[model samples]
Target: MSRIHSTHDDESIGSDSFLDVVSNIVGILIILVMVAGSRAKSYVREPGEAKSNIATAMDAEAAKADLRATRRTAQSLAGELDMLTREASTLANEVKAAEYARIQLGTFVATTEHELKKQRDELDDKTKRQHDLAARMVAARRKLDDLQREQISVVSTAAPEIVVKSYPSPISATVFTTEVHYRLLNKRLARVPFEELKDLLLDERRQLVWKLEDLPEVSGSVGPRDGFRLDYHFVRTVRGGSLTAAYYIPVESNLGEPFAEALAEGSQFRRAIERLDRQNTTITVWTYPDSFDEFRQLRKELYRLGFSVAGRPLDKDSRIGFSPGGSKSAAQ
Candidate 1:
């Protein structure tokens, strides 16, 4: 019996050992499962990190390209600014040159005007001096002429016989049957009508006649006459109830027409001479001082027509009348 009970206890111990081995195998399987879960979580996180890194690299390359483009634009703007600065400098120089030229022109004009004024002043002074010299020369010549005239009178008195022979003879008018009268007033010459002269001469109240010799040489005198005598008379009256003397200027005859017009028609004072006998005709010219040159021309014309010419010169204020003697009279 004892031997059999001991065999049973040994078999029970062998079963307990087999049970412990099985429990150890199950704990080892649980540890392997926990390790596998940790590995899976690590793999998911690693893939996400790799994608973020790739995006960062692309953004860096794009920023570098933008920086290069901005630098190129800045360089272009600097070159344009240099060109504008050069143009501004050239414009400033041109303005300065124009200002200098304007100043020079103004100075030159002022100097020229001053010189012209000086020249004008000098010319005026010279003209005044010349006028003074001319006046002095005229006065000296007049004095010299007076001295010569006085010397001539002394020489003439030394030779009485020669002076007597040189004396003019008394002119006789009996030889001339036809006599014409002329008057000069101002510078105009006119012939006195024959009818008007006859009216004045026939007036008995104004009749005056005198005979004289050696009359003074005066204005309107029949100078140096030896063969003929002159007769003149006129009435005197007040004009407009004033003290001024009334002068009756006779109507001019057609013979006293313009010489130019007469010459153009080939007719002159010859027409009046043809109406009378050539040997008995005489011409008397009453001349003013201003008409001396014109009287010379008339004298030459009368001589060509074979007629004698007598001249009676008058002063500026003389009037036509007869002297108490049988000669032309003049009154102021």
Candidate 2:
């Protein structure tokens, strides 16, 4: 029993030693497995980190490029805004200048209108004054004429006896020489520029001769020389023979000085008479009914001055005229 028990103990010690060897082998195998796993994990992590770094660097570069582009865009927008602001300011200044010019032009036009109105008013006032003076002169002349008429009527009614007077002078004869004409009307006396008007009519006849070809007669007017105008009628007749003739008439208006003023020294009538040669010029008086007394006085004065006088009695409405068939003046 002791021997069997000792054998069992020895088998058990052998089994125990085998078990310890198996445990040591298993622990070494586990340690080696853990080290290999750690090395493999480190290798995989290194590759993943490299990839992440590369992606991050690319993203940062893109971001910086976008920032630079954004800055450039902002700067461009700012420059455009500044340019627009300057243009707007320039337009505003131009508008202000145009408005000022319009205001100035309006003011100048108003001033010119005011000056024109003032000048018109002054001209109107002067015209009114001149008309008033002319009216007064006409009134005074009418009154004087009436007074003279009254005086002559009274003298004629008071003495109806005829007084005969004789003067030594040459016998009456037809006037065929140079003649000086005088007009007596409205108690006024004036020289008739008959010769000058006739000469002017002759000059106009030269120009009017061509008109006779189209018409049998032509009428024309000459000057207003010395306040008298000559209206003439020219006739062209082919009866029996071709004949051209002109009939001229003197038209008178406010053409004479008042008798009192005309008889004064250095008067227009006096100066005209002084310039005439009495020896060669026969004085012809055209007398109107209203101025018969004045004409008689003028005739006596002309006779006293050694000038032969011829009297032509004309009605109030008659115009002094000359014709080819008219009678010559008989002067004494």
Candidate 3:
């Protein structure tokens, strides 16, 4: 019995030992599993953190690039604005200068207009005075002519017993010889330089030939030589396809010497008469009604000098005129 009990006890001790070894192995496996799980979670968190850091750095770089571009754009705009401002200032200055120039021109024009008006006023005053003087002179001459006529009529009526001495005068005939012209008006005498005026008028007509092509009539005046001017009116007519020109010369009434000066010894009339040949030259007196007595005296003096005398009576308002178809002077 004792030997059998010893064998069973040994077997039970062996089984207990086996159970303890198995428990130890299981605990170790559980510890290993926990460690592996902790290591896996740490690895996953590290990878996610690395990805977030890389994305944040890229976003920061993009923001910096955008900021740099915005700064450059701002700088360019500032430069353009400065240039525009300077141009505006220059334009303003130019406008001011133009305005000043315009004002100066306006002032100058006003001054010129005022000066011209003043000169015109002075000229008008002078012309009015001259017209008044001319009217007075005409009135005095008419009164003198009336008085002389009255005196002649009274003498003729009162002197029936006195026998008047008369010279035998030839009948009047057309003057074909060289004629010297004289103006006997305003009780004054002046030599009419008809030849000199004719020459001057010829020159003027030559110069004005171009104007006659477009104008049917052209009027002009020659120079005032020896205080006498020749005013001429030229007419151009187209008849039967032929162009014909004719001119008329009108004498000015203001050209003559006073009676006292003309009758002087060294007068222009006496000198002109002394230079003329009595045989070839005839004295032509253009007489007005106001100066009939003066004309008679001049005619007697011309007859005494052995010169043929021609008398041309003109009306009060008549102007001495010459034309291509005018009648010749009749001399006695």
Candidate 4:
């Protein structure tokens, strides 16, 4: 019984030792499998890291190309800006020069205008002086012509005599055998125009009078008995190596009846004569200073008509149809 108990205890001890050994072997196998799995994961991570590094290098190259293009554009823009700045400076200088030229032209025009005005004033003064000198020269020429006429008259051998007479004297008994009337306008004795005298000479056929020198009575109501009768003798004379005509006119007629009828009703002379008696009434004419030449011509006609005429002289400035105290002559 002792032997059997000891053997059983030995068998139990052997079995426990064998179980410990098997557990140790299984732990070692598990450690080996974990180490292999960790190594394989490390290999896969190495390939991905290499691909990421290549992509980074390509991106750096692209960024370099873009920077170069940006730099070139900036340089070109700077050059264009410099050229525009220079053109702006040149235009500014040209504008300043044009302004200076305009100022100079304005100054020159002002000076020219002043000179032209001065010349115009001088011309007007000269023209006025010239006109005054011309007027003086004309007056001198007229005086010289009068002197020549006087000299010619003094040297003439067959010239008519100059007769001077006074007026407003008593009329002779035989003077009122015939009478005539005439007029003065605005208190001025207006002369007969030379053209009217020339027309009268032409109408009377003065050439026929030249042939009638041998006849005793060359004029007496030959044709129409008008207001006048002309008896003229034309004399030929050689003066200054030229043949000249010298004529003498004599008016011989009684123009009383016709002249009285021809006088207008409203005339001053007609009105005056109507208030006077017909017999032995003396007629007096008021003469103006301007009528000296006309009076001389009219005196001959009155003398031919067998009428004695008297004159009272008045000033040239005297007003006609005016009385004292500002009254009208007709109203008075």
Q: Pick the candidate with the highest TM-score.
A: 2
Can you write out model 4's per-residue Cα lDDT over 148-213, one digit (the tens) per residue? Answer: 999998888576888866533334333332232233433333221222333454555454445445
Per-residue lDDT for 29-52 in model 2, tens only? 456555545645554455557587
Per-residue lDDT of model 3, residues 1-332, tens digit only: 34444554565465556546555655654565455455445544544575775445554555456555555655565565556556555655655565565567667777998999999999999999999999999999999999999999998886568776553357888999999888777898877777787788777777666776787777768767666777777766553112122322334655667876776789878887899889888888888898998988878777888899999898988766687767889888
Worst 10 residues of 2 by lDDT: 239-248
Candidate with top lDDT is 2
Candidate 2 achieves a global lDDT of 0.72
Compared with the true structure, model 3 gives a TM-score of 0.46
* Candidate ranking (lDDT, best to worst): 2, 3, 1, 4
Please report how far candidate 3 places residue 224 from its true position, in Å. Answer: 1.3
Task: In model 4, state the lDDT of residue 171.
Answer: 44
Candidate 2: misplaced stretches above 4 Å?
1-162, 168-170, 239-252
TM-score winner, 2 or 4: 2
- Number of clashes in every candidate structure? 9, 0, 0, 0
Q: Candidates sorted by TM-score, descending order?
A: 2, 3, 1, 4
